[model samples]
Target chain A: MLLGAWGIALFLAGWEVVGQTGALGMSCPPLSAVLAVLADPARALLFQRALGATLGAVATGYGLGLVFGVVAAAAGHLLPGMRGGLDRTSSVIHAIPSVALAPLLILSLGRQATPAALAGINTYFILYVATSSGLAGTSPVLRDLMSVLGAGRWMRFVRIDLPAALPTLVSGMRMAAPGALIGAIIGEWFGASRGVGVIILNAMQNFQIPLLWSMVLLTVMISLTLFWLLGAMQLGAARRYR
Target chain B: MPTAVRVAGVSKRFRLDGGADFLALDRVSVSIGAGEFVALLGPSGCGKSTLLRLVAALEEPSEGQVTVAGSAPGELARAHRLGVAFQDHALLPWLDVTANIGLPFRVAGRAVDRARVSALIGLVGLAGFEAAKPRQLSGGMRQRVAIARALVLRPDVLLLDEPFGALDAVTRRQMNIELQRIWSEQGTTTLLVTHDVREALFLADRIVVLSPRPGRVARELVVPFARPRDAAVMRTEAFHRLADELTDALGGGA
Candidate 1:
């Protein structure tokens, strides 16, 4: 833990130094300047609205994606006939970049729901892969034992396969957190009314370097916090289930 | 005695990764009488475990049939009349000893019989460690929990594939002694697969030795030692002679 803190500290310090030196460009404003912009009272409501909008989209997308992913994986497991088709369909969906799909999603889902749709799509693919593989990875010996013990399909799933797949599922959840955030932000770039992504794009176009950097910093902090929380859950699940 | 488990002219074949058929057992037949303790003894790769798996309904025979209590192996399993343990111990890592032992009842959609579970825990000498998880226990302790689990449902037939094969010699012998005592009390028809000569001589009512690669029965011996046999029985002259003969047969078969 101490080593990880040191690594983060070193990285932040390096970023500050590069920004202070103007090594990259005018857009690479000093970290202190970005913090000042973030701390400014006049801009607080704007930042709050943007953060809330983005977080709401992320939550909706992530929850739906996780539920669908687990359900689809379970269905694939219980009915072997659908597994190949599920795999192929999810792969084809994931093959198309989210950015390319953003315009089509905007047209159908409208600008208001587009961020969540994009986020859900990204989360769905990641969780589907993780859950399906994890379900298949149950120990053969345990499966045999369950069979000999007269475990029915539902009993075996609840008692053995689900618990065994938990570690992998938690890890996938952690990964999907950042992906979901990215999807929401990217969706906002295609002209959402209010979001961190919208403000960042506006700042970039209008040459508001410190505001742009502040929004980026805020987005990263939110993503890291969610990732770190899920990482802890993943560790607990791994220790318990394995 | 009525038969508890019967394998009549059963053969098992596996399709290897290279798409070639690997014969595991060739027309192997064995009948275990009700309440009898039988051991299928053979060396590694002799397919004795395959035979046990057949009885456990974990695999289907390429030819012939396996029956337990006058029904198919799958039928017996579906009726929740089967119990099994393996070299890997096959205990759920997340469940404590009591929950693991109570798994069969839950699987059968029956209420958890706390008394029966506790009794079996005591029978396996894991009484005080009922709350311990599988990973927290030593290997022998884990195997003891597994044995307790196999006995918890009063299963009509117990299938054990090298339950003690991974333990040290001393622990294995100790487990054998405990298993004999446990079996004497329960008298559930059992078929244990192992390569250990002394293990077979010590615990089995009868030993059937099988030869390797497309396994066929090479020898069968009815143990002469009287029960409730103790460790001292293993030191007896009769035990030694039987052990030696079985060891020689296993070595020759390999």
Candidate 2:
């Protein structure tokens, strides 16, 4: 935890130093200017709204990814051929950039919720692959143990397979959570009236260095909170396994 | 006594590369009576474990059939009549020792009898360690938990495949004693496959010896020693004679 705080401190220091030095072509505001903009009531309301939109998108996408991934993975076991096919398809989907797919999603679903939903769709494949692989990795001996003991399909899944695969699932969620945030931000960047991504894009276009930095800081704080929540879940799941 | 399990011309063959077949067990036949403790003893690669798996109905026999309690082994297993403990304890690492012991009950959709679970825990000498996970327990303790799990359902037929092969010598001896006590109390028909000749002779009423490759029973020795036997019996002349006899029969230096 201390190391993580130190890393964030170092990052902010570097950004402040670079901005104050005027290394870039335009005027680059320091940390104080970013703090001043954050303190302003009008800018603070904008920050709140944009941050809310981005976080909402991320949450929606991540939740859907988790549900779909588990269902697909469970279905995969019953149909071996389907498992292979779905695995290949998910890999293909993962290879496509979320930024690249954003425009297409907007074209089809048109603005509200769809772009966010698209971002959520982007997170699904990673979760699915992680969960399916973890479930498949259950040892043959363990499977036989359940079988010989008269554990039917559902019982084996709930008692044995699910618990065994939880650590891997948690790890996948950690990976997917960050990806979900990135996807939502990227989706908003393409076309959104309000969001942290839109604010950053507008600030860049208008050369408002202080507002851009403040938005960037707010995005970082939100991401950190989401990641911390995932970490807590991981630690809780790990304790059970231990 | 009624035949608890019958293997009539049971044969198992695996398909090899280039469409060839590798015969593990060739038309092997054996009959075990109810409440009998039998051991299938053989050297490594003698299909002893394979035969045990067949009896447990984990795998279907390519030819012939296996019956447990007058029904198909697979059917009986599906009906919750078969219990198995592999060489590896095969306990779910995620579950606590008590939950591991109560697995059969949980699988059968029955509320775990906490009293019975505690008694089995005591029976296997793991009374206070109920909350421990499999990884935290020693190798012997894991096997004891496995034994408790097998007997949890009060199974009619228990199939064990070298259940203590992973343990050290001292732990193996202790487990053998514990196994005898459990078997006596439970009165479940047990088929144990082990490389340890002394273990087979110590626990089993009859020991069926098998030869290497294309496994078949070469000899069946009826143990003459009385029940309630202990490790002290291993020092007896009769026990040594049986051990030496089995060793010689397996082509090992005696």
Best by lDDT: 1
How many clashing residue pairs are found in candidate 2? 1
List the candidate 2 regions with Cα displacement exceeding 4 Å. Answer: A1-11, B17-20, B252-254
lDDT (Cα, tens digit) per residue for candidate 2, span B1-254 = 89999999988998989899989998899899999999999999989899999888788899999888888877777878788889989888778999888888878888999999999999999988989998899999999999888888888899999999999999899899989888889989999999999999999999988887788778889999898788789899989988999999987421
lDDT of each: 0.92, 0.85
For model 2, name the residue pairs that clash. A61-A120
Whose TM-score is greatest here?
Answer: 1
Instruction: Identify the runs in model 1 with alpha carbons over 4 angstroms from their true place.
Output: A1-11
lDDT by residue for model 2 (A158-181), tens: 877778888888878877876787
Model 2, position B28: C-alpha lDDT score: 90
Residue range B62-134, candidate 1, lDDT tens digits: 9999988988899888988888989999999999999999999988999999999999999999878989999
Enumerate the candidates' DockQ scores in order: 0.83, 0.70
- Docking class for model 1 is high
